[model samples]
Target: MIMRQGQQLLLPANPLFIWFSLIVAMMLNMLPVGRIPWMPDFLAVVIVFWSVHQPLRVGVVAAFLFGLAIDVHQASLLGQHALAYTTLSFFAITIHRRLLWFTVPSQALQVLPLFVAAHAIEIAIRMLAGGSYPGPTLLLAPVLEAALWPVVSVLLLLPQRRAPDPDENRPL
Candidate 1:
Protein backbone atom coordinates (compact mmCIF):
# COMPACT_ATOMS: atom_id res chain seq x y z
CA MET A 1 0.00 0.00 0.00
CA ILE A 2 1.23 3.44 -0.86
CA MET A 3 1.34 5.68 2.15
CA ARG A 4 0.45 9.25 1.31
CA GLN A 5 2.88 11.96 2.26
CA GLY A 6 2.87 12.98 5.93
CA GLN A 7 0.90 9.91 6.97
CA GLN A 8 2.39 7.19 9.10
CA LEU A 9 2.06 3.65 7.85
CA LEU A 10 0.16 1.35 10.13
CA LEU A 11 0.88 -1.84 8.25
CA PRO A 12 4.10 -3.72 7.86
CA ALA A 13 6.65 -1.72 5.89
CA ASN A 14 8.77 -3.02 3.06
CA PRO A 15 12.37 -3.66 3.99
CA LEU A 16 13.71 -1.49 1.20
CA PHE A 17 13.98 1.76 3.14
CA ILE A 18 15.63 0.19 6.17
CA TRP A 19 18.05 -1.79 4.09
CA PHE A 20 18.83 1.21 1.92
CA SER A 21 19.51 3.39 4.90
CA LEU A 22 21.72 0.71 6.43
CA ILE A 23 23.72 0.37 3.26
CA VAL A 24 24.12 4.10 2.91
CA ALA A 25 25.35 4.31 6.45
CA MET A 26 27.80 1.49 5.92
CA MET A 27 29.10 3.03 2.75
CA LEU A 28 29.64 6.29 4.54
CA ASN A 29 31.63 4.41 7.15
CA MET A 30 33.81 2.89 4.48
CA LEU A 31 35.04 6.27 3.29
CA PRO A 32 38.68 6.95 4.05
CA VAL A 33 39.25 9.13 7.07
CA GLY A 34 42.61 10.28 5.74
CA ARG A 35 44.13 11.54 8.95
CA ILE A 36 41.23 12.18 11.32
CA PRO A 37 40.28 8.58 11.98
CA TRP A 38 38.38 9.66 15.06
CA MET A 39 35.88 11.67 13.13
CA PRO A 40 32.17 11.21 13.86
CA ASP A 41 30.69 7.77 13.22
CA PHE A 42 28.08 8.36 10.54
CA LEU A 43 26.53 4.92 10.81
CA ALA A 44 26.06 5.13 14.53
CA VAL A 45 24.43 8.54 14.21
CA VAL A 46 22.11 7.31 11.46
CA ILE A 47 21.05 4.26 13.41
CA VAL A 48 20.48 6.31 16.52
CA PHE A 49 18.01 8.59 14.74
CA TRP A 50 16.18 5.60 13.32
CA SER A 51 16.08 3.91 16.69
CA VAL A 52 14.71 7.03 18.31
CA HIS A 53 12.11 7.76 15.68
CA GLN A 54 11.30 4.27 14.48
CA PRO A 55 12.08 2.03 17.38
CA LEU A 56 9.96 -0.84 16.08
CA ARG A 57 11.58 -0.54 12.68
CA VAL A 58 15.17 -0.26 13.96
CA GLY A 59 16.53 -1.68 17.16
CA VAL A 60 19.40 -3.46 18.85
CA VAL A 61 19.26 -6.33 16.35
CA ALA A 62 19.88 -4.04 13.43
CA ALA A 63 22.59 -2.25 15.35
CA PHE A 64 24.21 -5.57 16.18
CA LEU A 65 24.22 -6.53 12.52
CA PHE A 66 25.62 -3.17 11.48
CA GLY A 67 28.24 -3.45 14.16
CA LEU A 68 29.23 -6.83 12.81
CA ALA A 69 29.48 -5.35 9.35
CA ILE A 70 31.70 -2.54 10.52
CA ASP A 71 33.79 -4.88 12.60
CA VAL A 72 34.45 -7.07 9.61
CA HIS A 73 35.08 -4.14 7.33
CA GLN A 74 37.42 -2.37 9.75
CA ALA A 75 38.93 -5.63 10.95
CA SER A 76 38.45 -4.61 14.56
CA LEU A 77 37.63 -6.99 17.35
CA LEU A 78 34.56 -8.88 16.12
CA GLY A 79 32.10 -7.31 18.51
CA GLN A 80 33.34 -3.80 19.14
CA HIS A 81 30.92 -1.97 16.95
CA ALA A 82 28.30 -4.64 17.59
CA LEU A 83 28.44 -3.97 21.28
CA ALA A 84 28.49 -0.24 20.68
CA TYR A 85 25.58 -0.36 18.27
CA THR A 86 23.47 -2.55 20.52
CA THR A 87 24.08 -0.36 23.52
CA LEU A 88 23.45 2.81 21.52
CA SER A 89 20.20 1.42 20.10
CA PHE A 90 19.08 0.43 23.58
CA PHE A 91 19.61 3.94 24.89
CA ALA A 92 17.90 5.59 21.94
CA ILE A 93 14.88 3.27 22.12
CA THR A 94 14.30 3.79 25.80
CA ILE A 95 14.11 7.57 25.62
CA HIS A 96 12.69 7.96 22.14
CA ARG A 97 9.21 8.92 23.26
CA ARG A 98 10.43 11.82 25.30
CA LEU A 99 12.68 12.94 22.49
CA LEU A 100 9.67 13.72 20.35
CA TRP A 101 8.70 16.38 22.85
CA PHE A 102 12.01 18.10 22.28
CA THR A 103 12.66 20.71 19.65
CA VAL A 104 15.65 20.21 17.41
CA PRO A 105 17.71 22.19 19.89
CA SER A 106 16.31 20.32 22.84
CA GLN A 107 16.72 17.11 20.96
CA ALA A 108 20.34 18.09 20.58
CA LEU A 109 20.60 18.41 24.30
CA GLN A 110 19.06 15.04 24.88
CA VAL A 111 21.23 13.35 22.29
CA LEU A 112 24.56 14.67 23.57
CA PRO A 113 24.31 12.87 26.87
CA LEU A 114 22.89 9.74 25.28
CA PHE A 115 25.77 9.57 22.81
CA VAL A 116 28.35 10.03 25.55
CA ALA A 117 26.89 7.33 27.76
CA ALA A 118 26.43 4.90 24.91
CA HIS A 119 29.99 5.21 23.64
CA ALA A 120 31.36 4.96 27.13
CA ILE A 121 29.64 1.61 27.48
CA GLU A 122 31.09 0.46 24.18
CA ILE A 123 34.56 1.58 25.21
CA ALA A 124 34.25 -0.18 28.53
CA ILE A 125 33.02 -3.39 26.93
CA ARG A 126 35.76 -3.34 24.33
CA MET A 127 38.34 -2.91 27.05
CA LEU A 128 36.93 -5.73 29.13
CA ALA A 129 36.27 -8.18 26.32
CA GLY A 130 39.84 -8.77 25.02
CA GLY A 131 41.48 -5.79 23.36
CA SER A 132 43.66 -3.08 24.78
CA TYR A 133 41.31 -0.16 25.23
CA PRO A 134 42.46 2.83 23.29
CA GLY A 135 43.14 5.65 25.71
CA PRO A 136 40.83 8.64 26.19
CA THR A 137 40.20 8.83 22.48
CA LEU A 138 37.24 6.49 22.71
CA LEU A 139 35.31 9.24 24.45
CA LEU A 140 35.51 11.32 21.31
CA ALA A 141 32.84 9.19 19.65
CA PRO A 142 30.04 10.82 21.59
CA VAL A 143 31.29 14.33 20.93
CA LEU A 144 31.52 13.71 17.22
CA GLU A 145 28.38 11.58 16.98
CA ALA A 146 26.26 14.12 18.84
CA ALA A 147 27.53 16.85 16.55
CA LEU A 148 26.34 14.83 13.57
CA TRP A 149 23.05 13.51 14.98
CA PRO A 150 20.78 16.28 13.72
CA VAL A 151 22.41 16.33 10.33
CA VAL A 152 21.82 12.59 10.02
CA SER A 153 18.19 12.99 11.13
CA VAL A 154 17.47 15.41 8.30
CA LEU A 155 18.20 12.66 5.79
CA LEU A 156 14.66 11.41 6.35
CA LEU A 157 11.34 12.98 7.19
CA LEU A 158 11.11 13.62 10.87
CA PRO A 159 9.22 10.78 12.51
CA GLN A 160 6.00 11.69 14.25
CA ARG A 161 6.07 12.28 17.94
CA ARG A 162 3.27 10.79 20.06
CA ALA A 163 -0.18 11.29 18.59
CA PRO A 164 -1.45 14.80 19.15
CA ASP A 165 -2.44 15.41 22.73
CA PRO A 166 -3.54 18.33 24.86
CA ASP A 167 -1.23 19.69 27.55
CA GLU A 168 1.77 18.10 25.98
CA ASN A 169 5.18 19.27 27.13
CA ARG A 170 6.23 20.24 23.69
CA PRO A 171 9.80 21.21 22.91
CA LEU A 172 10.88 24.75 23.39
Candidate 2:
Protein backbone atom coordinates (compact mmCIF):
# COMPACT_ATOMS: atom_id res chain seq x y z
CA MET A 1 0.00 0.00 0.00
CA ILE A 2 2.84 2.41 -0.70
CA MET A 3 1.65 5.87 -1.72
CA ARG A 4 3.32 8.18 -4.23
CA GLN A 5 4.99 11.43 -3.17
CA GLY A 6 2.18 13.75 -4.19
CA GLN A 7 -0.66 11.37 -3.50
CA GLN A 8 -1.00 12.28 0.15
CA LEU A 9 -0.43 16.01 -0.24
CA LEU A 10 -2.36 18.20 2.18
CA LEU A 11 -2.22 21.95 2.64
CA PRO A 12 -3.43 24.19 5.43
CA ALA A 13 -7.17 24.83 5.49
CA ASN A 14 -8.09 28.33 4.34
CA PRO A 15 -11.33 29.83 5.69
CA LEU A 16 -11.51 32.23 2.79
CA PHE A 17 -11.55 29.36 0.35
CA ILE A 18 -14.33 27.64 2.25
CA TRP A 19 -16.61 30.66 2.49
CA PHE A 20 -15.84 31.87 -1.01
CA SER A 21 -16.60 28.45 -2.45
CA LEU A 22 -19.97 28.37 -0.65
CA ILE A 23 -20.88 31.86 -1.86
CA VAL A 24 -19.89 31.02 -5.40
CA ALA A 25 -21.94 27.86 -5.27
CA MET A 26 -24.94 29.82 -4.05
CA MET A 27 -24.59 32.25 -6.94
CA LEU A 28 -24.35 29.39 -9.39
CA ASN A 29 -27.57 27.93 -8.00
CA MET A 30 -29.39 31.17 -8.71
CA LEU A 31 -28.22 31.42 -12.29
CA PRO A 32 -31.06 31.83 -14.77
CA VAL A 33 -31.51 28.66 -16.73
CA GLY A 34 -35.02 29.48 -17.86
CA ARG A 35 -37.64 26.77 -18.38
CA ILE A 36 -35.27 24.07 -17.18
CA PRO A 37 -35.99 23.80 -13.49
CA TRP A 38 -34.03 20.61 -13.04
CA MET A 39 -30.64 22.22 -12.52
CA PRO A 40 -28.45 20.42 -9.99
CA ASP A 41 -28.45 22.08 -6.58
CA PHE A 42 -25.05 23.72 -6.42
CA LEU A 43 -25.59 24.80 -2.84
CA ALA A 44 -26.22 21.25 -1.75
CA VAL A 45 -23.15 19.98 -3.54
CA VAL A 46 -20.87 22.65 -2.11
CA ILE A 47 -22.32 22.22 1.34
CA VAL A 48 -21.70 18.49 1.15
CA PHE A 49 -18.11 19.05 0.07
CA TRP A 50 -17.34 21.59 2.78
CA SER A 51 -19.24 19.73 5.44
CA VAL A 52 -17.24 16.63 4.66
CA HIS A 53 -13.87 18.39 4.56
CA GLN A 54 -14.35 21.08 7.19
CA PRO A 55 -17.08 19.84 9.43
CA LEU A 56 -16.03 22.02 12.33
CA ARG A 57 -16.07 25.16 10.22
CA VAL A 58 -19.09 24.34 8.10
CA GLY A 59 -21.66 22.49 10.13
CA VAL A 60 -25.41 22.12 10.41
CA VAL A 61 -25.91 25.75 11.40
CA ALA A 62 -24.26 27.03 8.27
CA ALA A 63 -26.24 24.62 6.18
CA PHE A 64 -29.46 25.77 7.83
CA LEU A 65 -28.68 29.43 7.26
CA PHE A 66 -27.62 28.86 3.68
CA GLY A 67 -30.73 26.82 3.08
CA LEU A 68 -32.83 29.70 4.39
CA ALA A 69 -31.08 32.08 2.05
CA ILE A 70 -31.70 29.69 -0.81
CA ASP A 71 -35.34 29.38 0.18
CA VAL A 72 -35.73 33.14 0.16
CA HIS A 73 -33.78 33.51 -3.04
CA GLN A 74 -35.86 30.97 -4.94
CA ALA A 75 -39.10 32.01 -3.26
CA SER A 76 -39.91 28.38 -2.60
CA LEU A 77 -41.33 26.88 0.56
CA LEU A 78 -39.47 28.51 3.37
CA GLY A 79 -37.32 26.07 5.37
CA GLN A 80 -37.61 23.37 2.74
CA HIS A 81 -34.09 23.73 1.50
CA ALA A 82 -33.00 24.51 5.01
CA LEU A 83 -34.27 21.21 6.32
CA ALA A 84 -32.84 19.29 3.42
CA TYR A 85 -29.44 20.94 3.75
CA THR A 86 -29.43 20.53 7.48
CA THR A 87 -30.04 16.84 7.14
CA LEU A 88 -27.48 16.55 4.35
CA SER A 89 -24.80 18.37 6.33
CA PHE A 90 -25.46 16.23 9.36
CA PHE A 91 -24.87 13.07 7.37
CA ALA A 92 -21.80 14.51 5.70
CA ILE A 93 -20.33 15.58 9.02
CA THR A 94 -21.03 12.20 10.52
CA ILE A 95 -19.31 10.28 7.76
CA HIS A 96 -16.65 12.78 6.80
CA ARG A 97 -13.74 11.01 8.41
CA ARG A 98 -14.67 7.73 6.76
CA LEU A 99 -15.09 9.50 3.45
CA LEU A 100 -11.59 10.94 3.57
CA TRP A 101 -10.11 7.46 3.45
CA PHE A 102 -11.56 6.76 0.01
CA THR A 103 -10.74 8.18 -3.40
CA VAL A 104 -12.96 10.96 -4.78
CA PRO A 105 -14.95 8.69 -7.05
CA SER A 106 -15.51 6.23 -4.24
CA GLN A 107 -16.49 9.13 -2.03
CA ALA A 108 -19.08 10.08 -4.61
CA LEU A 109 -20.53 6.60 -4.42
CA GLN A 110 -20.80 6.92 -0.67
CA VAL A 111 -22.53 10.26 -1.02
CA LEU A 112 -25.15 8.96 -3.42
CA PRO A 113 -27.30 7.79 -0.56
CA LEU A 114 -27.04 11.13 1.16
CA PHE A 115 -28.07 12.91 -2.02
CA VAL A 116 -31.04 10.59 -2.28
CA ALA A 117 -31.95 11.31 1.31
CA ALA A 118 -31.84 15.03 0.68
CA HIS A 119 -34.10 14.69 -2.34
CA ALA A 120 -36.45 12.50 -0.35
CA ILE A 121 -36.68 15.24 2.22
CA GLU A 122 -37.71 17.68 -0.48
CA ILE A 123 -40.28 15.32 -1.84
CA ALA A 124 -41.69 14.71 1.62
CA ILE A 125 -42.01 18.44 2.13
CA ARG A 126 -43.89 18.84 -1.13
CA MET A 127 -46.16 15.98 -0.36
CA LEU A 128 -47.00 17.31 3.06
CA ALA A 129 -47.86 20.62 1.46
CA GLY A 130 -50.29 18.94 -0.93
CA GLY A 131 -48.20 20.07 -3.89
CA SER A 132 -48.04 17.96 -7.00
CA TYR A 133 -45.00 15.81 -7.41
CA PRO A 134 -42.53 17.28 -9.91
CA GLY A 135 -42.33 13.85 -11.53
CA PRO A 136 -39.37 11.51 -11.82
CA THR A 137 -37.25 14.21 -13.41
CA LEU A 138 -36.92 15.74 -9.99
CA LEU A 139 -35.02 12.68 -8.84
CA LEU A 140 -32.47 13.21 -11.56
CA ALA A 141 -31.04 16.27 -9.85
CA PRO A 142 -29.41 14.16 -7.13
CA VAL A 143 -28.00 11.72 -9.68
CA LEU A 144 -26.56 14.56 -11.71
CA GLU A 145 -25.15 16.14 -8.57
CA ALA A 146 -23.56 12.86 -7.52
CA ALA A 147 -22.03 12.51 -10.99
CA LEU A 148 -20.52 15.98 -10.66
CA TRP A 149 -19.12 15.21 -7.23
CA PRO A 150 -15.76 14.14 -8.63
CA VAL A 151 -15.36 17.39 -10.52
CA VAL A 152 -16.36 19.41 -7.50
CA SER A 153 -13.99 17.46 -5.29
CA VAL A 154 -11.03 18.01 -7.63
CA LEU A 155 -11.67 21.70 -8.18
CA LEU A 156 -12.03 22.42 -4.50
CA LEU A 157 -9.00 20.32 -3.62
CA LEU A 158 -6.75 21.91 -6.25
CA PRO A 159 -5.78 24.91 -4.14
CA GLN A 160 -5.08 22.73 -1.14
CA ARG A 161 -2.95 20.24 -3.05
CA ARG A 162 0.79 20.67 -2.60
CA ALA A 163 2.93 21.28 -5.65
CA PRO A 164 5.76 18.81 -6.36
CA ASP A 165 9.04 19.80 -4.75
CA PRO A 166 10.91 22.05 -7.19
CA ASP A 167 14.27 20.76 -5.87
CA GLU A 168 13.48 17.16 -6.69
CA ASN A 169 15.65 15.67 -9.40
CA ARG A 170 14.10 15.86 -12.84
CA PRO A 171 13.86 12.69 -14.91
CA LEU A 172 16.99 12.57 -17.07
Candidate 3:
Protein backbone atom coordinates (compact mmCIF):
# COMPACT_ATOMS: atom_id res chain seq x y z
CA MET A 1 0.00 0.00 0.00
CA ILE A 2 1.20 3.49 -0.81
CA MET A 3 1.42 6.00 2.01
CA ARG A 4 -0.19 9.37 1.52
CA GLN A 5 0.97 12.71 2.86
CA GLY A 6 -1.50 15.13 4.35
CA GLN A 7 -2.98 17.56 1.86
CA GLN A 8 -1.24 20.90 1.75
CA LEU A 9 -3.39 23.97 2.31
CA LEU A 10 -2.82 27.60 1.43
CA LEU A 11 -2.44 29.98 4.33
CA PRO A 12 -1.52 33.62 4.65
CA ALA A 13 1.92 32.53 5.72
CA ASN A 14 3.16 35.90 4.47
CA PRO A 15 5.46 37.96 6.67
CA LEU A 16 3.58 41.15 5.80
CA PHE A 17 0.31 39.92 7.31
CA ILE A 18 2.15 38.85 10.39
CA TRP A 19 3.78 42.25 10.79
CA PHE A 20 0.49 44.02 10.11
CA SER A 21 -1.27 41.98 12.75
CA LEU A 22 1.44 42.75 15.26
CA ILE A 23 1.43 46.48 14.57
CA VAL A 24 -2.35 46.62 14.77
CA ALA A 25 -2.22 44.82 18.06
CA MET A 26 0.28 47.27 19.44
CA MET A 27 -1.87 50.20 18.36
CA LEU A 28 -4.85 48.65 20.08
CA ASN A 29 -2.88 48.39 23.30
CA MET A 30 -2.31 52.15 23.21
CA LEU A 31 -5.84 53.09 22.19
CA PRO A 32 -6.53 54.43 25.70
CA VAL A 33 -9.78 52.51 25.89
CA GLY A 34 -11.04 49.76 28.17
CA ARG A 35 -10.20 51.52 31.45
CA ILE A 36 -12.76 49.65 33.59
CA PRO A 37 -10.39 46.80 34.27
CA TRP A 38 -10.05 43.59 32.23
CA MET A 39 -9.17 44.97 28.83
CA PRO A 40 -8.10 42.52 26.16
CA ASP A 41 -4.37 42.52 25.58
CA PHE A 42 -4.47 42.72 21.81
CA LEU A 43 -0.74 42.43 21.49
CA ALA A 44 -0.70 39.35 23.61
CA VAL A 45 -3.45 37.84 21.51
CA VAL A 46 -1.53 38.51 18.29
CA ILE A 47 1.63 37.12 19.77
CA VAL A 48 -0.28 34.06 20.89
CA PHE A 49 -1.58 33.59 17.35
CA TRP A 50 1.77 33.97 15.63
CA SER A 51 3.46 31.92 18.30
CA VAL A 52 1.10 29.06 17.63
CA HIS A 53 0.92 29.29 13.85
CA GLN A 54 4.38 30.52 12.98
CA PRO A 55 6.41 29.35 15.90
CA LEU A 56 9.53 28.90 13.84
CA ARG A 57 9.65 32.50 12.70
CA VAL A 58 8.02 34.32 15.58
CA GLY A 59 10.22 33.50 18.51
CA VAL A 60 11.81 35.26 21.44
CA VAL A 61 13.44 37.86 19.20
CA ALA A 62 10.13 38.85 17.74
CA ALA A 63 8.64 38.80 21.18
CA PHE A 64 11.40 41.01 22.43
CA LEU A 65 10.93 43.50 19.63
CA PHE A 66 7.17 43.63 20.01
CA GLY A 67 7.41 43.98 23.75
CA LEU A 68 9.99 46.67 23.40
CA ALA A 69 7.82 48.50 20.91
CA ILE A 70 5.00 48.47 23.39
CA ASP A 71 7.34 49.63 26.11
CA VAL A 72 8.56 52.53 24.03
CA HIS A 73 5.12 53.45 22.70
CA GLN A 74 3.38 53.34 26.06
CA ALA A 75 6.28 54.52 28.18
CA SER A 76 5.29 52.20 31.00
CA LEU A 77 8.57 50.44 31.65
CA LEU A 78 11.51 49.49 29.51
CA GLY A 79 11.12 45.77 29.80
CA GLN A 80 7.73 45.30 31.33
CA HIS A 81 5.93 44.29 28.13
CA ALA A 82 9.09 42.86 26.70
CA LEU A 83 9.61 40.55 29.61
CA ALA A 84 5.99 39.46 29.67
CA TYR A 85 5.65 38.97 25.91
CA THR A 86 8.97 37.21 25.55
CA THR A 87 8.12 34.84 28.34
CA LEU A 88 4.71 34.15 26.87
CA SER A 89 6.08 33.57 23.37
CA PHE A 90 8.69 31.18 24.68
CA PHE A 91 6.01 29.03 26.28
CA ALA A 92 3.54 29.45 23.46
CA ILE A 93 6.04 28.23 20.86
CA THR A 94 6.73 25.21 22.97
CA ILE A 95 3.14 24.06 23.47
CA HIS A 96 1.58 25.37 20.29
CA ARG A 97 1.56 22.02 18.55
CA ARG A 98 -0.14 20.26 21.41
CA LEU A 99 -2.55 23.14 21.74
CA LEU A 100 -3.67 22.61 18.14
CA TRP A 101 -5.37 19.42 19.27
CA PHE A 102 -7.50 21.27 21.76
CA THR A 103 -10.91 22.78 20.97
CA VAL A 104 -11.44 26.54 21.06
CA PRO A 105 -12.85 26.44 24.60
CA SER A 106 -10.01 24.25 25.80
CA GLN A 107 -7.53 26.53 24.07
CA ALA A 108 -9.06 29.45 25.94
CA LEU A 109 -8.50 27.53 29.16
CA GLN A 110 -4.90 26.97 28.16
CA VAL A 111 -4.41 30.65 27.39
CA LEU A 112 -5.56 31.60 30.88
CA PRO A 113 -2.41 30.36 32.54
CA LEU A 114 -0.20 32.13 30.02
CA PHE A 115 -2.21 35.30 30.40
CA VAL A 116 -1.89 35.19 34.15
CA ALA A 117 1.79 34.52 33.95
CA ALA A 118 2.31 37.42 31.56
CA HIS A 119 0.26 39.78 33.71
CA ALA A 120 2.16 38.78 36.81
CA ILE A 121 5.44 39.30 35.03
CA GLU A 122 4.36 42.67 33.69
CA ILE A 123 3.38 43.79 37.16
CA ALA A 124 6.63 42.59 38.57
CA ILE A 125 8.57 44.37 35.89
CA ARG A 126 6.69 47.58 36.57
CA MET A 127 7.46 47.30 40.25
CA LEU A 128 11.09 46.60 39.52
CA ALA A 129 11.15 49.71 37.36
CA GLY A 130 9.85 51.77 40.31
CA GLY A 131 6.22 52.10 39.32
CA SER A 132 3.24 51.43 41.54
CA TYR A 133 -0.04 50.83 39.78
CA PRO A 134 -3.69 50.35 40.61
CA GLY A 135 -3.94 47.15 42.58
CA PRO A 136 -5.91 44.17 41.27
CA THR A 137 -7.43 46.20 38.51
CA LEU A 138 -4.17 45.80 36.75
CA LEU A 139 -4.56 42.05 36.81
CA LEU A 140 -7.77 42.25 34.82
CA ALA A 141 -5.88 41.97 31.52
CA PRO A 142 -5.09 38.30 31.95
CA VAL A 143 -8.65 37.12 32.51
CA LEU A 144 -9.95 39.30 29.72
CA GLU A 145 -7.25 38.13 27.36
CA ALA A 146 -7.97 34.55 28.31
CA ALA A 147 -11.68 34.99 27.66
CA LEU A 148 -10.77 36.55 24.33
CA TRP A 149 -8.68 33.61 23.25
CA PRO A 150 -11.33 32.10 21.02
CA VAL A 151 -12.15 35.31 19.24
CA VAL A 152 -8.51 36.12 18.65
CA SER A 153 -7.87 32.61 17.44
CA VAL A 154 -10.59 33.03 14.87
CA LEU A 155 -9.32 36.40 13.69
CA LEU A 156 -5.80 35.15 13.38
CA LEU A 157 -7.03 32.08 11.54
CA LEU A 158 -9.02 34.13 9.07
CA PRO A 159 -6.24 34.48 6.52
CA GLN A 160 -5.97 30.72 6.48
CA ARG A 161 -9.55 29.72 5.89
CA ARG A 162 -9.90 26.74 3.59
CA ALA A 163 -11.39 26.80 0.14
CA PRO A 164 -15.12 26.35 0.04
CA ASP A 165 -16.35 22.83 -0.42
CA PRO A 166 -18.73 21.85 -3.15
CA ASP A 167 -21.48 21.21 -0.60
CA GLU A 168 -20.68 24.24 1.54
CA ASN A 169 -24.04 25.86 0.84
CA ARG A 170 -26.05 22.91 2.07
CA PRO A 171 -27.22 22.93 5.69
CA LEU A 172 -26.43 20.01 7.87
Candidate whose TM-score is highest: 2
List the global CA lDDT of all models. Answer: 0.74, 0.87, 0.80
Ranking by TM-score: 2, 3, 1
The best candidate by lDDT is 2
- Model 1 pairs whose backbones collide: none
Cα error, candidate 2, residue 12 (Å)? 1.3
Misplaced by over 4 Å in model 1 are: 1-15, 34-37, 129-138, 158-172
User: Which prediction has more favorable lDDT, 1 or 2?
Assistant: 2
Q: What tens-digit string does per-residue lDDT give for candidate 2 at 42-95?
A: 899999999998899999999999999988987879999999999999999999
Q: Write candidate 1's Cα lDDT for 28-147 as tens digits.
A: 888876525356777888888889877998999999999999989987778878988898899899998888766666787788887777667666776687756566766776787777
Write one digit per residue (lDDT tens) for candidate 3, span 87-163: 99999998998887678789989878998999888777777778776577767778788888888877767777655
Q: Candidate order by lDDT, highest to lowest? A: 2, 3, 1
TM-score of each prediction: 0.74, 0.89, 0.83
Query: Global lDDT for candidate 1?
Result: 0.74
lDDT of 1 at 137: 66
Query: What lDDT score goes with residue 115 in model 2?
Result: 90
Which window of 10 residues has the lowest lDDT sum in candidate 3?
1-10
CA RMSD (A), model 1: 7.9
Q: Lowest lDDT 10-mer window, candidate 2?
A: 163-172
